[model samples]
Target: MAKYKIWVVAAATLLLLAGCTSLPGTSSSSSSKATKKLQTTGKVTDSMYEGVIDNGQYKTSQTRGLTTQQSNTSFDVKSLESGLLKLSKEQFPTSKYVFQEGQSLKTAQAQKWLARKSKTNTEGLNPEDNGQKDPNKRNPIYLQQILEQDYLGEDGSMKGMSIGLGMNQVDYYTKEQYGATFETKISKAMMTQQGKQMANKVLSRMRQKKGLSDTIIVIGLYKQAPKDSLVGGTFFAYGVSKKGSTTIDSWHELNQENQVLPVVNDEKAINQDDATAFNSFKTQVETFFPNLSGVTAQTHYEEGVLAGMNITVNTQFYSETEIMSFTQYIATAADKYLPRNIPLDISITSAEGMQAYVGRASGSKGFTTHVFGSY
Candidate 1:
């Protein structure tokens, strides 16, 4: 069985945007002085994990398992960091990859900053308003920090370079509203364009950096939120020395083949089985803990095989120890009733915070659970 780890970061306050905006193109002629300012501005944090890839081989085709951390504001940067490190090692082994993390400014703050910089009227713009007249005209703001790290050769000469870039677009509506086919398609297309523009801006900035004429720049787009699931956004890589750029498709794209399957073993029968099992589990939870507000379960299948199961429970009144016990009970029940080899993600949200558990059935009647989230 593959061991899937859940990486959780502290949740920031969610800032809502009323509309989307066209991302502006960045100028490549900005002085090296400007590049230095870009590197110094914003809150700079140390790399979560950084070192040479001692494994000797990068896992390009490995399937990343499901995670419990959903996209709250933007794409998960921790996951992106992990992916970029692997890609840089594979594509530019001798080059040093420097990843400087960047964060999105609050909607109001960003609007004011943009208005002051451009000397334009940005009045009457509210990012938290979801009732905007035209959804297509709304543009969210993303502020990026640009920095370069050089890989030096034995003779103290610059061999190669890598730079980190970040951007985000706010989701105006909830996931339920985004479920419509047309809406999802339009949103994805717009985000993809925004991502491309942001990548170009990073490239332009990299060009301004001193002594980076021949370098490999890796650009990462953070996931923007107001989404239902953890799977959010995409990433891109550019080789300045090679004059080529490639957009790395995410796992969500790779799993598209499993979206639909032929009706075998009676689709309705399987749904009924899952519904019955889930209902029974919910009943047990409610019975054991009367304080639980509700329990909801949703199951997903691929080619008639159980692919995933999501359970959300309101844990407003449970203690930490009690929640842990409840999670174990649910895992044991899942192992008994649910199909094997599929992931089961349970989210327990309360006034304090959120706690998530990822459980997978193992040996005969055995289940393994990995817990995540701030709570």
Candidate 2:
């Protein structure tokens, strides 16, 4: 009945080892460069991330400050933020255009767009309430959230924009005023349609705000996971709106997918071979050390091919020697069991903290290891 959203997930990305050793397990110490003065620069990362330069300082998203965090999972948030930039590059290449957080979409405007549609505020993107108190009869909020990113030319002018629509696969709501919470599953077909339609409407409004009718706009439709999902959602499709248009001219489908380790369900396995490899790696670690808690992994894929994997190894031991030994063993196990020619990062963590780290960059010959505090 109301725009009440809750998100119970919050986490930071895995730490990138500051010190490490290359394959063959030879230890080496490394130090980072000295801090440099801020400049009016826009640096793009290998992950397709581009930052803006405002008065010699990099700026973050304006809409990000408005996120409740309780209403969305960190996985979904990360995927949306990163995936949108990656997709937008197809149209707004980093070579010519720089990346900036959506500045045209203000906090109040985004809040209004995310609110439930009602007579008092028709600008709400979600469907208007039907005067019904029954949860089943009420219209579910298919559109959960909206994200905006801007593309800027070298001259600091707006070149293009990318908009991400976060569609909820499950709507959490109450049957009546202050009643018990109930969830309604939203089918993929309905969610996609609503997202596409919302994109058109959003374009119209954006054009009105800053004469964006003459600007190129990218739209990313993301299907968010359930409220209690461990992993975030994936972008299923994206579209481009050419200049002088407020609607998408063409849509392209994206086949990016992610899988949680331990093979939650055999029937839902993304790839049987990959699962076998992960299982073997897990078995090797457990067999060597029985006191360890568990080992799990998350696989990322693009166009049905394994692109990257982030593995987490939980343990109960706190000894530095034990951690170093375990890290060395896992690096070997990963080489034997994990897929080759793909980026992979393993975090060995315990109640104390992250004990050790192992990683392999894409196209790299071998993995790198770093025992925390050793360097």
Candidate 3:
């Protein structure tokens, strides 16, 4: 039997409670420096869906399929343990999950996996036609088809993506003997400089406590292209399972409860020194995790900040050919219209060498972009 399967839309209503989930803001709305506001009215932003599932709509829809065995009900602690064991062993066989004596897998390892799965499952609730009108607004463009593939195991459960930004917050869902609830919040100041530091720290803690090994897919967006766009700087991450399975994924971590929010860096409000400081931190992350293929960065707008700047740096695997094409595109664009350091809100950067900074970082004859540390 297939290890993974897709759950139908009917599962949505049965699986989740009736509540509105605050999704990530994808629109690059125009906002002045002093006053910034998000584009709220249009399409429902963020990966999660709103309202209850429409059963009538599901039956009439030709696009989505209904899997009979899938169950949307919340899992109990016992079921969570069994399901997680099966999932962990099947999905990550090489890196076995080693449990400590007297520790409950459901409370720790299983809880982590389920929380991640719930986040991914929420993505299914979005009406299919959302981004059809505007393709550019779609998250992980060119990667959605991969997500359609089967990732969830059988036993009526779906798998969600768990990713975390290096900020101060951690978002997740859990149920104890008492009750079940979902949580999200910003990270503490001492955790990191700003943003979502709790995610990385939580993941680290999980790895040590539950023997969970993560293959991160990092995504970073920027207001302007760096010096190079090809090898080093373009920000995006892709996942390739060792079993040779490939999936389009977001830049997040499992330990962080898989909060799917775009990490938008505001550039207009900060000075060059501060921008460079952020870049330096990014460089450190890139250097630490050399396995990343390349990061895809888009020059998106931020409402309410000074013509605000938004940037992202992701971790994932990509073929060298794809990286080359992305890099060249950025370099060509930069050469045509050179955006100055200040008041510059552009995508990608110029390359000084023939290699990319993130991938192998080696190539003598091609132009390469700086992956991290260029602001």
Candidate 4:
């Protein structure tokens, strides 16, 4: 219903402009073209995604799912607040827009950070079936960090994390679902800005239906083009929710007898470092979920899977204010750094109260992590 309303309003605005235009000559062609484009709308329609192939099998599809975490903690509200304030200022220095209601600058930045780009204007990617491991697999920790830094306050403060997972699969979608594509590699700024605009519209609608609250986390899957094929973008939707002490760690311990941890995932290709600084982020989460223990972390490498463990002690007092504070802190710590610009903080607000949320989304020979945990 809300989507319909937005479309209606947008159409009305366009029609009003058309009514004011003098359209008997070249103006007629221009107006007609503009109207056709507007009618096309950047949104993917049901008919656009009718025949998609998932893993080689032809099937019709729709997208939907849920992932969340909920827990009690001992962190004091003051500590949480102090932590969140600091974290927010660092993660989102220019983030003046309210996260859930008006203005969303962080969302704009994040979409810009993740949108894809091609080197050649007319180049195309073959659905490479090399059977090689996917380089884009998101580490569970990486996903978590994106949330802490991008969505929560500076100290990881959040009231309560409200997470929602949805999936939208059309039978067939085309490049028209999204806007224009330049031949030369488009700049990240351009893609991110476009992505930001889309993200804001979706989030604003969610806010209207659910009420104005900063405590919401969402991850959704939209129809994606085939691997190497140009189509619309669809994957995850996450927002901020809450923060508590929970042991979150990521590391790579190669079985090889090299001096330091060998930068390898398996017996095959070896180059990408599995031990990024973000991989060692564990103690930070423990500050929220003290009783967190017996948890294990692992990465599926070319050889097999590397595993590690940690026991996070609830090292702080807990309260409403404390929980909110902790929420913001964890969100910041989990954000992704984009060189000089303030790091892009990903929001996962809904998963705040969930016990554990873990899953995977695979498309175009690529896969992304969908994991959430609480104590």
> lDDT tens digits, residues 87-188, model 4?
233233322211111122244333322322234311111121233222332111011001211232322233222221111121112223354421212233
RMSD of candidate 1 to true structure, Å: 14.0
Q: What lDDT is reached at residue 321 by model 2?
A: 88
Task: Give the total clashing residue pairs for model 2.
Answer: 4
**Candidate 1 per-residue C-alpha lDDT over 141-247 given as tens digits, one digit per residue, 9 for 90 to 100:** 33222223334332233445444333344433333455542122134455556555555644554455565545455554434323444332323333333343332
**TM-score against native, each model:** 0.42, 0.83, 0.18, 0.20
Residue-wise lDDT of candidate 3 within 1-375, one digit each (tens)? 001001111122222222223233322222233212221111132211221122211111111121111111221111122222223333332121111111212223323322212344432211222322222332211110010111121111122222212111222223344346333332233223222222233334434432234332121210111112211111111222222123322332121100001124432422333344345544554565464444333221112122112223333434555445544544444333222231221122234223333211111223335533324
Q: Which stretches of candidate 4 lie over 4 Å from their true place?
A: 1-33, 37-274, 288-320, 334-375
Q: lDDT rank, highest first?
A: 2, 1, 3, 4
Q: For each predicted model, how many residue pairs clash, with residues at least 3 apart or on different chains? A: 12, 4, 52, 88
Q: Can you rank all candidates by TM-score, best first?
A: 2, 1, 4, 3
Query: Evaluated with lDDT, which candidate comes out highest?
Result: 2
lDDT of each: 0.39, 0.70, 0.25, 0.24
Error of 4 at 140 (Å): 32
